[model samples]
Target: MLLGRDNMKFSNKIVVAVIVGLMSFSGVVVAEDINTEAIGNAIGNITSEIETAKEIQSEPLDKVRINWETIPGAVSYRLVIQNGESTSKDAEVKHFNRIPNNGYELDTANMFKAKDYYWRVCPLDYDGNVMGPYSAPKPLIGEEVNPKAPLATTEFEKMAYSPLYPVFSWIPVDGSGGYEIRVSRENKFSPGRYEVVREMTTKNNVYYEEGGYTWPGHYMWQVRSQNKVGEPNTEWSEPKYFDVEQHVRVAALGDSITHGGGVCNVPPGYAMYSWEYYSQVPIKNLGCSGDSVQVMAQRFDRDVMPFSPGMLIIMGGVNNFRAGEDGWDTIAAMEQILAECQYHNVIPVFVTATPINPGLMSKVPTIEPAAWNWKEQQQLLNQWIKNQPYHVDVTPALTDANGNLKAELTTDGLHPDHLGKKIIGETISNYLLTTFPSYNLTEK
Candidate 1:
């Protein structure tokens, strides 16, 4: 007894032809064997709506999205989040691929103001075969009110202070992907006064860590949250204040290659050692291994731009070169970093990477001629910096007479050893003296 031509069971026996259709016109794959598993699949068909989206909080840019159960036979989903109130309708139509990733997220930019939003889904097969159906029009059902940044927040009324460092607390908000912690010297300022500092992505409230001391002055700070969606910037919370005395603030920003991975088992990295030897100013390290010029561009505002330092010593490009990051275009990213510093009135100091020891090449296989190749990229990056205003080159001080890693000078193949760091430090100190000779040297 045949159920049907495609094996669809009607009564139990009578023969008939049934077409299991694919929603897309390109769907013409005839699998005579049939997908037995799809029959009575609990995952259900495409048109059937899964659980309604919950916790749909409003954020900047009408960044509306939904969380739903996976549909049967679905390899990915078509998500359409839209607002229909104003002429500038915000819409995010993306197809999220299914992967073993823990979860998924989307950035919904280009949103409208004050309007109703409509959303739906199209479950698709591996070939994006829509599961025969489309969801009924589901209105995101929103108020047409213009969205604003999260209301400013602070942890407490009475603030505590530390001479070495100070910490600020802030109440947490959900729609926020990150925060901007602001600190002010006095009282009233501008609409967005205080230094704008961004926090990392999180699930809870944010607390900012103060790395070192201050001028023992009364300081007030605040927090502003942000989503990766529309306004790449964040709005700050109300202000909080604290007091401290005096400490010259200084820090370093570089790539992992500068974090002193090379034979560095001690603190006060070679950079700090250099700072101590050259000037009396203390310094901190801000290097991340394998970081690229592009990533640096994205983080420039967050990393270099915020500090508002008198001087910023930047050392990197080894990872970029080693990663085969295109040399011609890498400077574009570097230029952005420079622009940000210039905008903030911060001095940009360009330092070449300490020379690479050939023997160091044996340790890292991914890097070919690892040490030698890295040196060339460092030099090329410096050459690009030569024409920039306010740019100070620290190359002559770190490299050997023959442009090779000094065999007797360096302790390790890759990084500066104690003795090597000392020499490097002296060189930079001398340059600083010759260039800015006015910097007060506190030490004898």
Candidate 2:
């Protein structure tokens, strides 16, 4: 016996009170006028409906996707989802001990049911210990929005110095065979509005534009996922804007250290981790991660020619040394880079290679161990760098007496964290101000 639709309009408590009042009134009149059994059934149906409404209101979402803010100095994160009556750390339905990024998509098809679910995340250190307390449990309430195209993850700086070779990266879509990227002076993205458009198919998640934009102006770029047959799978991502300027006062060119990023999970695309971000002076970052001295030399023509900066800060050879390349070979490559700078009338400022800690490197799975003779090779290269015409030695500030990178300054041993990058930037900033007093005159 269910309550009629019209009866549901009344509050359950009010309806029950009204029924009790009617029964008392009926005792004073003809009791045969009202059916006692029908009244009892109506009361039972109303009670059941009230309980069902509470359940529906309490657990509204059928599926959920979780996202959280990135914690500084966190190497990874711990995510836990529990489904139970209370928000306790019990009845764990799913637990991820380590998540590299700030987001996770739960398997709704198999994992979620008509139950109340709560989720929380905690920042973790390299050793997997919790760096901070778990976030307050958040109600997991909505279906994950799955886009057809890959999601763009690169965070572009608002302004960049001339010779812009921006790195574009994205989270790969589950079924995407490849991706397409477009850059334009206009955001409309019409046929002729594109300034630089290239469709590339690569399994890797990043792309470095070799033919970079030279002119200083505003630019817009977007990316989309594609299938193996070259058909578009997703709509183009929302356009991201960045500005490029000509006639920059200074610029840093090197490998991952100069390219920026640390703490394992963050990528060089983030400006906060770059030394340039902390410097008092304005310096364009032309650094690329995973680049050796040889690769830097090879790309010099394509990367540096467009901007043709007034001054170029050269820092490299760590990649070569860590891979066991000979010291002289690395030195020779640096010389080649310097010779090119001199020919173009660009002031070449050499930044000495910082040392590495094998112990720290071993802890990060993505970072390979330093070669047996890496220290010897690094010393040789640094010594040569010091002899260059204009140089900044950040080694002394970053390394210990044993010539190893200070553990406090780095998370992965190879790349310096924010604090270490601050030291490097300040050191270089002080040097530039003293050596070239007019260096930052053109800074805007």
Candidate 3:
């Protein structure tokens, strides 16, 4: 049966034409048949989304390079680098290239200031037709690595009792090769006053365990970082002050929420009030943001016990809950911390985890949907806390009827604001006065 050209499938027509041509050339010198399998495989080799370096590679501007894997069937590649922070793509397009290789070495001509950039690659065929899909956008210096000293967090103006070696810690700097920590008795960093010089290869956030800080003396410490590329060390960080007080009346230890947050609409978002505002006794704020119960337990000796506080208020657990831990896990960690306090004769006071709201939870981009389960664990932990002999319940005064944070008391659902801080401070103050009758708490 004769088939009309329009009626025949395209692939069938190609096969019929090829067979007819072979038959006609049977008696003549004809080349071998075209390999359809090879053609199909070649087309299949054009893979989309070429693998590339981390959106932000930890390198300085001059050392940065745009790198990607070579794609099959790709004769060339077109690259685009744009300012990630720009409002329009054209305004920030710093470099555009149709290069022959899988990577591009950047020079000052296409370089930008210390800022974030976006980059992508599109595979091209021999004639410049795009072969496969453009890669997903990647950041060039998505986040700039910290080029200098990490800020020292613990032991800042803190006084540790003698015989207790305090741990020192700082915020981790991205892309740092290591850190050099220096401690000196005199603030001037003179020749003889320096006590310790240690280089840390571990992540900077963890406390340095080598102790030797003595009591009834003033000490200062600073930190600087080695560049990731083996470059010279960054400038020394500003000094932080610490004193070795023989006796500590009180200390507040918890996660970042305890460090004082929800200070938005106010400046310096983390802390709104200091230790002096919360307690009438000589106390220190030993809170670090994002610390889980396990983290607190690990640092108990260096962060909490060194103060030799007569009363220690423990408020934490939300981070653990958010990380998928339940009430029992949190309680176990709490028991360990409480036991440590007991061993040292330091009184322990338990503070309930603050509340969270569904409305406010979504505002934080990094917080996942699983965070919704945080409240249930928090409630269970808070209830268990209240059952303890000595505890302060912030949940009752801090929550709304629906188990969410009271709107007026918090700037974010997690951390309290002025109103909530007042409630907690007053509650702790009352507990301290009633628990320890002889201690004088006049402001110094």
Candidate 4:
């Protein structure tokens, strides 16, 4: 039977009748005889499916869909839509700043009066300033169409250390009911040329593989959208390439700063915001966003032991200090991390915590202001860091005369932007090149 919107109410009534009949068959229905748990579960499943169908049917259709390729190093984008052939500022009908993704869907019912329109996009830095030339203006066609394939957003190629447990992610399609991801060992994708490693469908735009790759080798992945009826709505996206290496020379472990990304909206997956992206030498990113010193110490074996690198760069405690954690407690957690590294035969390298800017922090509502004594706590931590066997001081370059993070280098004030990240990367890179020249070989 076709279970569609028209028949859903009728179907629900029938289901209710059946349930009543089953219960009424016996004067007093026993839980054991009716299998109440199974019936309840079945009803729940049906309700969930019905709700999903309703959601898909209620989604609004876009009047026009605009898509662009992701630009490297861009924290966000500025999208301009004009009324005529000219994409100039004077002819602009609409302009959007800090668009976090490569695509946008516009509802032109009331917005577009002209038959022809043009749109262009320019990548932006954390401060909303244009970072590159605008994309060639493309005609914006106003028409209803099927959902388009999602754009893969992960920068797998730039990752210094491919996680044993990898997360595949992509931009969400405007009208998609769900997504399907396919991974293969070969790039060709054809039946004979490619060996399919894994294929799965999900309602989410991101998927985490708990059981990661068993063997290290080259891998390629792509994603596509599905319609409400579970049919393919769009073709597969351009495949992203990445390698699963068996080992690495260096790895970095810490919080969001070590993980990369900034400017509030952008994530570490963008690569350009990653310090590892700017590093001359390859350093695996073991950084996790929102991680505290205690959490880092807790997850060290699970997250860090897989790659088994010769050196592990540790930079954390910002989250701790900002949240008002005690300096000695934070240091104790760091000491645990250092001890674990020693046990694993990995050289522990310390990176001084970068200062925070409260003025900018207040600007982004999502970011909490640092503790009143965060600077004092940071000084305590940095002093301990300086006393470590191997350390890299990034504070000097990022701090101002008053010891606050330089205003120009960050957007959110907590996470540094590309320029600041570049400084940190290059500083660590130079330190690695000078101190451990043997591990400085170019990553394949």
Task: Give the runs in model 4 whose Cα sits over 4 Å from its true position.
Answer: 1-76, 87-90, 93-98, 105-116, 122-136, 140-147, 163-169, 177-217, 226-236, 438-444
- Clashing pairs in model 4, backbone N/Cα/C closer than 3 A: none
Query: What Cα-based lDDT does every candidate model obtain?
Result: 0.48, 0.76, 0.62, 0.79
Q: Per-residue CA lDDT of candidate 1, range 1-444, in tens?
A: 645645554431221123233422236655464454564343344324343322233335444324444343343556554454232224543334432111122334554432355555566543445554645545553322222333322222221112123334343343566665555655344433444333333333433343433333556665556676634354554455554533324445665444432232222221222333333444434444456777766766555434445776676665676555565567777887778778877677766655566664454454455533555576677788776654555556556766756655443345554455555545555555577667653322
Better of 3 and 4 by TM-score: 4
- Give the alpha carbon lDDT tens digit for every residue of 261-356 in model 2: 788867766566678876777788888778899889987887777676788889888899999999999999999999999899999999999899
- For residues 27-48, write the lDDT of model 3, one tens digit per residue: 5433355455553444345322
Model 3 spans > 4 angstroms off:
1-183, 187-217, 221-240, 244-246, 261-276, 441-444
The numbered model that scores best in lDDT is 4
Which residue runs of candidate 1 sit more than 4 Å off their true CA positions? 1-250, 257-278, 364-376, 400-402, 409-412, 439-444
What is the Cα-based TM-score of model 2?
0.74
Ranking by lDDT: 4, 2, 3, 1
- Candidate 4: tens digits of C-alpha lDDT, residues 299-385: 787777777788889999999888888899999999999999889899999999999998889888788888998998999999999
lDDT for 399 in candidate 4 is: 97
Candidate 2 stretches with Cα past 4 Å from truth are: 1-63, 84-87, 110-116, 142-151, 158-165, 171-180, 185-196, 204-217, 225-233, 362-369
